[model samples]
Structure formats: structure tokens, C-alpha cells
Target: MADTIISNHGSSEKGANPLPANSVIVVLGASGDLAKKKTFPALFGLYRYDLLPKNVKIVGYARSKIEEDDYKKRISAYIKVLDDKVKKQLEEFLSFNTYVSGQYDKDESFQVLTKHIEELEAGATEPHRLFYMALPPNVFTVVAQHLKRNSYPKNGGARIIIEKPFGHDLASSRELQTSLEPIWAEDEIFRIDHYLGKEMVKNILILRFGNEFLGASWNKNHISSVQITFKEPFGTEGRGGYFDQFGIIRDVMQNHLLQVLTMIAMERPVSFSAEDIRDEKVRVLRAMPIIDPKNVIIGQYDKSDDGTKPSYLDDETVPKDSRCATFAAIVTYIKNDRWDGVPFVLKAGKALDGAKVEVRVQFKDVTSGIFKDIPRNELVIRIQPSEAVYLKMNTKLPGLTTKTSVTELDLTYKNRFKDLHIPEAYESLILDAINGDHSNFVRDDELDASWKIFTPLLHYLDENTDIIPAKYPYGSRGPAFLDDFLASYGYVREQNGLYNWPHTSANGKL
Candidate 1:
């Protein structure tokens, strides 16, 4: 069957909704690390850029009992300021901000919080409220319910923003959704997967659909494999208590990498509307079979070869017998017309290699003959630390005997878009939530389908104590099995020592 529009349940029938005119943007868990580091910084970023709504008021609520001045100081600690002008702007951004001390579950606490919001509202005829939760997952439903019961805007619009690690697996995810659906409608709840807000990730749509050259060859027919990689150079560093429970798969691959895959593999939307875009994402996810163990390689990072860093097991918080995988390389397939038989390899890990997030789409080798054993044409989208989109292709040397060489049609962001200020992921997502756009946020069924793909493997890892994770030293590429894993998927790596990007040290110091 040809691709058809599968579902259209979530977009507003009235078309895109306008930004809320009178809104109180509440930040829950305002004192927490996520809020301090990302949430507040992004909001300040919006204020700096004047992207915040005209009549918006930001109110932060949390359990911390700090004085108003101290709370402001704490949240502002992570925001960077270069000069006196920005320093004044930061102060002004924090001026209208109101902090409330309260528990997430208590009704009276919410009542007090509502009073604070109401005071900030100053009696608008119809108020709009957006509650952004930076809290832990276990408290999500409770916080939403309390907000709805005591602090929901009186006969007005209310929205809630939540972040990921949505649930441990499919069952818990469904349960979490079931509990929240009653309190907030599908459109009102923004399930944030920050990867969707990434510059290159968002650009995938235009790069694929806008360019005829790419769209023409975007299927299994021309492409050999797609690899999305997220690597970090640092380990848990005493954060392992929480990291141990989820491991790398739950932390990175299931939510972040899978999201990037959908953008790469999903069919074009009917109209680029929020629901239309998300519907196709769900379809791409649903078409994927659950990942089988044979197609996966898992590893835990040990002490770096130089002994400069500690191993994962060295953390006092991590269980000595923990079999958690800090690194994983998985090859999954989509059983749809566009991607049948093509392997989508997703590799992610911590404490090995330099920090980067990127996607590499390697096309099949040139039709037999003269290009013998040459490098395949590959398109790479670099997502961080100098964003870029480059296509690596084999070409003839500019002079001398027509010798073959490799070069890129490079579009590095710093070099190409020098004047542009690429907004941080949180900044973009928060702005989207304020504007009532779900285009970049995950949907209910999208979450369900994602958990379904990884739940069985997660369960298997939990039950099989004998399955020891392969070990690779910190700051290494990954487990020794990485090469074999990719080879099994028919991945075609560039010939060794054949070429390197113009940037990066020639001596392999990332």
C-alpha cells in the first residue's frame, strides 16, 4: 500500500492558535538543576530576544524556602551576561518574576500558588496559564492535577509542558498518559523531547523535502544505511545514582536518537501543520519492529586509558554488580515502503570520544565499475559545537592526471551563517509552547510507539544477569563490538586514512 495520511487528531481545526495574550508562564521545580540550568536560561534568552509574549508574566513555584532575592540569584546563576546592557536586561527579566514556596501535591499549597498567579494576572477577563514542569517524572501527574484543581485559569486556556524520560517502558508510559489525559487535553499538554528543537533536526524537513536531489534518493532504493550518533566525553561524575537506573538506552537512545530517526525517515506531512507532522512521526515509529538483542551491542565505560577520569563502576553511587550499559549501538529496521531492508543504526554513549550529536546517511556505492572501492557519498548533519551540513562525495583532483579524491560540499553554520543566533533547544521549545505550537513536541501515541520499541530489550537486560556488558575505556570510541555491530548491518565506513574533514586535528585529537 502506498503511504496515506494515517491520522489527524491533535491540530486545531481553526488553524494555528495565536500566542496567548494574557498568560502566566509558571515554572515548576524552579529551584532544581533542570530549571536553573535550562528552563530559566531559556526564558531569559527569550526575554533577551523579545520573543516572549507581550502580556506574559513568569511565575516560578517550588518547595525551596529561599527568600525572593536568593531564589532570583540562584536561578540567574547559570545565565551568561557579557556586559552592563545584558546585565540590566537580566535584572529586568527577573523583575516581574514571582517565586512561590509550595509542595506539588498539596491543595492548599496550590491555592496559595493560584493566589500568586492571580495577583500577577491582575484580573484579566480571560487568563491563559502555561505550567512548565521541570520536576521528576514521578511527581508529574500529581503536579498537573493540583494545578488543574486549584490554579486552573477561570474559564480560560491552560497548558502544561513536561519533559522526557517519559516512562520506563510502554506500560508505565501508557499509565502516565492515562492519568494526565483526564486533566489536560492532547493539545494542552506539550511533551518535550528537546532533540526536536535542535537546529539541524528541525532543518531535516527542509533539507529532505525542499531539495529534490535528496528527496529523490531518500529511500531504501538508493540509501544503504542511516546512523545517528550522540557521544559524550564525560562520565556520570557522581551523578551515577540516577544514571544507573536508566542507563544510556533509556537516557539517550530511546527518546533523543529515536526522535532524530523519525525526522530522517518519516513521510512528508500533508500541510506542515502540527498534527500532520506528528502523525507521520508516529507512523515511522509504528512501522519499526522491536529491537532484537542480536542487533545490539552494550557496554559500560571503564577508566580512561590515561587514568585521568574514573570508570562508571568507580562511582560510589553505582552498584558494584550493575550491568547497566553506558554505551549502546543498535541497528533497527523499518518495515515500510520507504525504508524496508535499510538499517537505521543508532549509536550513543558517555565517557568515550569527543562530545557530539550527528546523523550520517551513507548512500550505496556507485553502480559497479570505475569507481572501484571508492568512498560512498555520505550526508552528515552535525548538531552541536559548530553545527554543519556537509555532503562527502568522491571527486577528481583539481589537477594532475585526474586522480580521484574525496571532498565535501560543506555548509558549516559558524562559517556560513555568521550573523545568525541559533536559539538553544529549550528556548525554541518554550517559545513553541507559549505560542500553542505542538509541531516540535512529541505526541501521546509517539511516546507509546517509542517505548514499545525498547521495552522488551530493557526487560531482557533486567532479567538476564549473565549478560555482562562489554567494557571500553573512558574516552574511547565505544565497545570493541561496535565495528562488528555496524558490519553486520552492512554499514560502509569510509576507507581508513582516506580522508578527514577540513576541521579537526590531523593527529586525531578531537
Candidate 2:
């Protein structure tokens, strides 16, 4: 099958093409929330920016009884076209859109889909196919196997895009790999973890590898500890039934938080190739020691006094007797020479007072100080709510007599870069998938190592009610014991009233 020429309708002058237009992108589970809210919007964005190929087409697949026009209307409603030029470009992009309705588990339906794709690719050169799976974890194996057995393109390049929550545990994840092995080559399968697509997250490599200053101080000898946090202000919002099952560990820490951790902790790769980066990340993940239950804490949201918010157990989806944790904090240790004995603490919670994502690296304190007291040095990488990097070190106070105080070396994205637009995580990840850039995608070994480290804890929580999660009020920082937990490890709560350590050492002591 050659590349298909669905339409030559969009303008081509906005930016360099990210992918050839003739590439055919097939999105599975097209009627789901992810497809409507994220997948299509990202494709439309690429089209609007002229990053798509001239003859590209998008094939939406699901079991919905929806017409092509209705699909277009739904996509239009969700796509954020801010200007007249973008709106016109989107209309042109829509001209190349098509939809297929079918049962994902049925071979006959997949064969029909394959036939339709062949028909769409009637006449063109360099035909490429990207199969995107935006469905639930349970269906990933079924869909991947079905595509392998029935729908893979016979000619041109073929790639399969899979969403996260890859497996419930290590064994299941490996099982998934076995199921996908026959149908897709390792290189052709992309396991997307969207956090890698965030603008700040991408900058981690650049900040460490591209700059000589930060690179010099990014090891165990100079740094004391690393902290990664993902806080959500809103509760499960009546979705606890689904959320409670996975909790914070599997839902956030396993994939999103670990991706950030590996990017920060892994050794610099020789090249920017996906394989090289993933190789480095796998090394870091595999080197991480098993987390002791004593160093881990879990929490749930309690009922609020205001009576306006629903508790986790009150959600229609969650069982009244559910002991699922809504918050989790782990003090992980990486056994590698670079990070041995250094704590890599990860904390995530829903229904917290505020939402924030950041990485704080606290440097070892200066051994000797000529001044009466010396302040510790620190580096903070902010990922969300604001995207920026800041360095905290001691400096002389203005118009003061021998007075020094801690200050920040601020590099705020909004303040420094005017008119710069940060693309959404889904948009970036989608584009990377289309272009076959797997640097941000999760590899099989990495997934296995991640599960191996956390699965025991998950199982422990499931079997023992004595280790039941604590409950905190909504709009609160988290469980009251969060401070005690950190303090036990020689970490002190910061003056900002958050559970964080100073980025730099004060007076040369860690």
C-alpha cells in the first residue's frame, strides 16, 4: 500500500512540516474522552500550524454508531481554534478526515478497517501508517493483537501508539509485551507517558546536558536529595470508583513521576536517539532499590466540614469499605554509585489544597564558612502552574551591614520568553508519535523495572487493612503525618509551609 492522498486542502506556509502529509494516522477508541478532548485537538493543532504533511488523513475507529459529519462536529466543538486563519486551516484539515465504526475484538471488523485504509491510500508515494490506541488498559492487549493479526499495513512504515496504565503489575506488563510481540516490532510500538511531553520536562535534558554549570553539580557528590511532587487540588470528582482501584502509586508515580525521576537521574546518553535515552532511563529504573514499607506513607481524603465536597468513599464509583489510598509518599533510594544513600522522595495526592509539579534538588552544605553563617544552595525545577527554573543561594542584603540572605536566580518562562506558546502535553506527545520520535515513550524493560519496585507495596496495601491509608480533609496540604514522615528522614519542612527542603545547603552543612 502506497501513501494515501485524502486531500490537499490546508496551507503549507506556517512552519516546517513535522510529518509528511501523506501519512495515515488511525486513532483507535475515537469516541472516548481522550480522543475527543486530546487526540483530535492535537491533530488539529498540527494541521493548523502546517506541521502535517500535504496529503495526510486521520481515520477514527470505535464501536460508536456515529456518522462522519457528526464526528467532525464533535471534533470541531472540542478543538480550540483561536483565530480566523487557524479556523480556516482546521476546515481544510477536516476535509481529509474519515471515521470507521467496528468492534475492536472482532477480526472481521478489523479486516474491514484494513480494507478501508487500503482504499484511502489509493495513489501516493511514501505511505506511512500510525495506529493509535487511546482506550483502557484492559483492551490494549486485545486491540494490539487484533491490529497485528488483521490491520497492519502490508506496505509503507507502520507504528502503534499506546496510552499509559500499561499494566497493573510487572507480570501483567510482561504479559502485555508477550501479546504485542508477535504483531509489532519493539521499535514500532510506542508506549506514551504524557509527562515526558511537557515543555519543562523536555527541558530537563537541555538544562543538565546543554549547560556546563548545572551539569557539573547534578551528581551525588554535590547534591543531597531530590524531590518530585504531583499535587491535585480537586478530589476524584465522583470518579473514585475507577481511581480508587489504582490509587496514586500506579496512577501517577509508576509512569509520570518515574519518567521525570529517570530523566533527572539517568546518565547523559551518547546521542538524542530514542533508544539511547530509553536505555539510560532503564538503567536508572533498574538500579532503584526496593522501597521499604517503613519509608512509604499512604492517605485518603476524609469528609469536609463545609458539606460541599464528597469524600472519597462517598463517590458512587468507590465502595463504602474501600481502603484505596488517594495520596502516597515514598522515600525511594537509587543504589547506583551516582545516587547511593540519597533519597528520591516522590509525593502525589488528590484533593490537596493546590496543584503543583516540581523537582527540588538540595545541594550539600558548604563545609567551612568565613561568614558567621552560610546559606545552603538549591535548584528548583517547576513543571506546572508555571514552567520555570530557579536557583537559591546566599547573597548580601541590599543596604545592609554584613547581612546575607537567601535569594533566587529566577528563570521564569512567562517572564523571560515573550509570545512563546507552550504546546499541550497531548499535542507534543501526539506529534512525537507521528514523527516516530520515541525518546519520550516507555520501553518494555523500563515498565517492568518500575512495576518490580512498586508492586510489592501495592500488594501489601491490598492484603493488609492494618496498613490502611490515613484520611485528610479536602483543601488541605495532605495527611498530618506527612511532616513526621519526612522529619524521620532528617528532612525539615520549609518556611513556605509546604513539605519541601531548601534547594541549597546553608552554612556548608547538609
Candidate 3:
């Protein structure tokens, strides 16, 4: 039997606090990389901020036969403590932690695990339960079913947290859902997309809905096109085996990129509830036109001149004859009342020139060139490598030659707010799950709709290997044809000298 420890914290004001501190959390696959590097650290961060309930107990479940102290030691190796104060706080929080060894597929093991949790929280005030699946997608259903059959609390709030890649495509996702539906309700299941929890990603909603200036111009009449890009400089390294299996399309474009696009394009919800927000997002996703093959481009990294890195096929883990795409760029269209005829281009790759994640909304050029020298207006939302919002528009030059040049109205987080710590993506997401705020969680319908749009392209690529991925050198700005790809659609690359997309379409053309 596990020791039952009790701790008390301040009470909440009213219905605002739906979950209690005495809630029990069971993290399946607690020994995995994600659990050690992300989940435990995130939970500790929340504990340090007192965002978690004081009486809470975390049960680390895995098949590994490790002692409690040893497990903590292993986790501590990767846990990041930015300050000495946080280090001390994390130590205290870890005291309430316990571990349970169990075979994922065995019922008897899960029952024992349940009894241990019951003993640990024997005297807790509330018996709320949250089951977080940190394991791979393959074991999600098994763990969910076991928990439902043997461990779910009969009373109070019961929730399950699932991580992505939810499924390879729609059918698998639906099957995954069906397997869990018997155990959890839609409201009780939180499907996390870490990108949705990013500080800047959340700001997408705040920027568009909270500000009058941007909101007024966010429509088909004023915007030309929206471009979103997620690029990284590092290749797959030793992880090419997994990368080859999933490819850039399913790995990044399917969930992260699509979620970002939906957030930017969705109509304003009546309330900020999970369902309300997801409903609007589904509408936009459903409205997105089927991707035209002619508008899509794919690429793979070629060996560098200096031979410092291996190409995709050269990686030993990846099959030599594989035709998986390492890079994907597509132009999407959203046919709706507010965004009809607008072009939304999305581009993502593993090894690129620099680490960049940004959304550029290029506004239509001035109908009448009041200032002959003025450039087009634009709004940029930089999500990573830096977090900032900039409004680019025409402004009079200091000199007197009647020249107008583009200038930016910048609001940078690091510059304006000094020493402020934005929590990691996992931290924000775990905290939201603890609080039962599903606003950032993905919905089942949304997942299905996303797969519907991309499954065709995925199958098309799998069937046709002749559409080979273009070869581009590592640390370069992708294939040289990127500019020509955009040019074919009547859009000119901007002065930023970078070929990327913005958060929302600036002028609604592609």
C-alpha cells in the first residue's frame, strides 16, 4: 500500500475552480523521453506556481522495474530548473510523487496500480482523476481502455489527456476515438496540440479579436493572402527512421500548421469556451478548398558541399529507397463569406537556412497610389526565434522628395516586458488540462476534418513516387524554385528577402 499524505491550500472563490487539489493524476509511460523531459518538468512548473492542487498525487506508471528514488533521479537529470528557488520548490513537490510498475496490456497490473492510487489519496477531500497518456499513439487506446475498465473514479471530474499525432489519417483517428469513447466523454477528453498553447499562438486570437485596428481590416476586401512557415535548420539526425515514416506533411503540417491556420482564419466565437471556439474553427477548416496538386511543391534535403550532414536517403535509419518528403509547401484556399478567393500558403521543413516560425499577412496594394513610391501594407506575427507583432504600412520619408516608404509598428514581448518568463508549450498545456480548460485542446470533428483535407494528398504522394521531392542544400532557403512557385500565382516576394507566409492573408490573393 502506498503512503497517504495530506496537504492543504487556500480555497477558491466560487465555481471558477472546477477541480480540487486532491485530484489524482496518473501518467502512463512515465519513463519515456516525453515524460522526463517535458511532462514532469511542466507539472513541477505548475506546482511551483501553485497552479496545482496541494493535495494532488502524481502516479508515474510504466513497465520499468525502477524504485521510487531512482525514478526521481532519472527524471531530475533532464528536469530544467531556471532558478535555485524553483529547484527547491520542485524538490518539495517531488515528495508527493510515487511510481507503479505495470504491463500496459495487463488488467491485473492496472488494478494494482489503481489500488495504489486509492491508498495514496485515501484521505483526500475530493477524488477527481486525470489520466495523462504520455505513451506513444499505439498504446493510447490500450491504456485508455484499462483506465476506463479498472481505474476511473466514480465521482467528481474525470478527464484524460492525449498527445498528438492523434492518427495517421481520418480512419485511424476515428478508430482511436471509438476505442476511447466507451471510457470518456468528449468533454472529459483533452486532445492536446502543443502549438495551440504557445504564447504567440494564443495571441493570434487576442490580436485579432481584442484589437479594433487589426479586426477592422481582417476580411477578404482588405487582405490579399496568408502565409505560414515553420522551418528548422537541423536535419533529422538519428531520428530519420521516424521522420521518414511520418514525413513533413503528417508530422508538422497536419496538426501544428493546420491548427495555426484555423485559429487565424476562424470566425469569432460567441464565448471563449472550448466547444464555441472549436465550432468556429471547424467551419473554416471545412470551408478550405481541396488542395490543387498544381499549387503544391515538395522537397528533400541534398547532401551539403562540405559533407557535414547526411541527406534523407543517406541516413542509415531511413530506408535507402524511401520516397518520403522532407519538405512540403502548399497553397490553400478558404471559400467563405469573409475569406472567399483568398490564398493561404503553408510551408514547413526540417533542415532549412535558419530557425524561423512566422505568419505574414500581405494586404492588398493601395488601389490608387497616393504615394507613388509607397509599398504594400503588411502585418507579421512572429511566433518563434522571437515573439513580436508588427504592422507594416506606408510612411513619409524624413527627406522632402514626396517619397513614402514602409515602416513597422512593432510590439515585441521581450523588449516591452523585461525578465518575463513565458512558460514552455508543455507547461501551459498541462496547466490547462489540470484546470479543465479545453479551449486549446483539439476536438474530434476538427481532427476528422483536418485529415479529410490532407488524406488525399498523402495517398496521392504515396502512390506516385515520380513526383520526387526537389533537392535543396542544407542551411539554404529551400529550393530555388520557391520564388517562382509564388510568382506563378501573381504574388511578389516582399523586401524581407524571405519566402514565407503571414498569420492571416494581408490582401487575400495568392
Query: What lDDT does each candidate get?
Result: 0.88, 0.82, 0.82
Candidate 1, 162-230: lDDT as tens digits:
988798999999999999999989989999989988888888987888789899999999999999999
Q: Score every model by TM-score.
A: 0.95, 0.91, 0.92
Error of 3 at 148 (Å): 0.6
* TM-score for candidate 3, residues paired by index: 0.92
lDDT tens digits by residue: candidate 3, 343-431? 88899987788898999898887777454424667788999977988887665556657554455688787876555678888889888
lDDT of predicted model 3: 0.82
Model 2 misplaced regions, further than 4 Å: 1-21, 124-126, 368-375, 495-510
The residue pairs in collision within model 1 are none
lDDT of 2 by residue, 1-510 (tens): 133233332212122124466778899999989989988888887776766656887899999989899998877778877889878888887898899999989999999998888788776465678888989988998888888788766556778988988888878888888988877898788898889889999889878887898888888898877889999999888778788778889999988998899999999887777778889999998898777888899999987758777789888889998888899999998898888888888999998889899998888777875764365677889999788898876676566476665767888888776566788888888777766677788888888899999888788888887877898988788899898887676553452431122333434223
Task: Supply the global lDDT for candidate 2.
Answer: 0.82
Model 3 residue 506 CA deviation (Å) reads: 26
Cα lDDT of candidate 1 equals 0.88
Badly placed stretches (over 4 Å) of model 3 are 1-17, 496-510
In Å, residue 407's CA in model 2 sits off its true spot by: 1.6
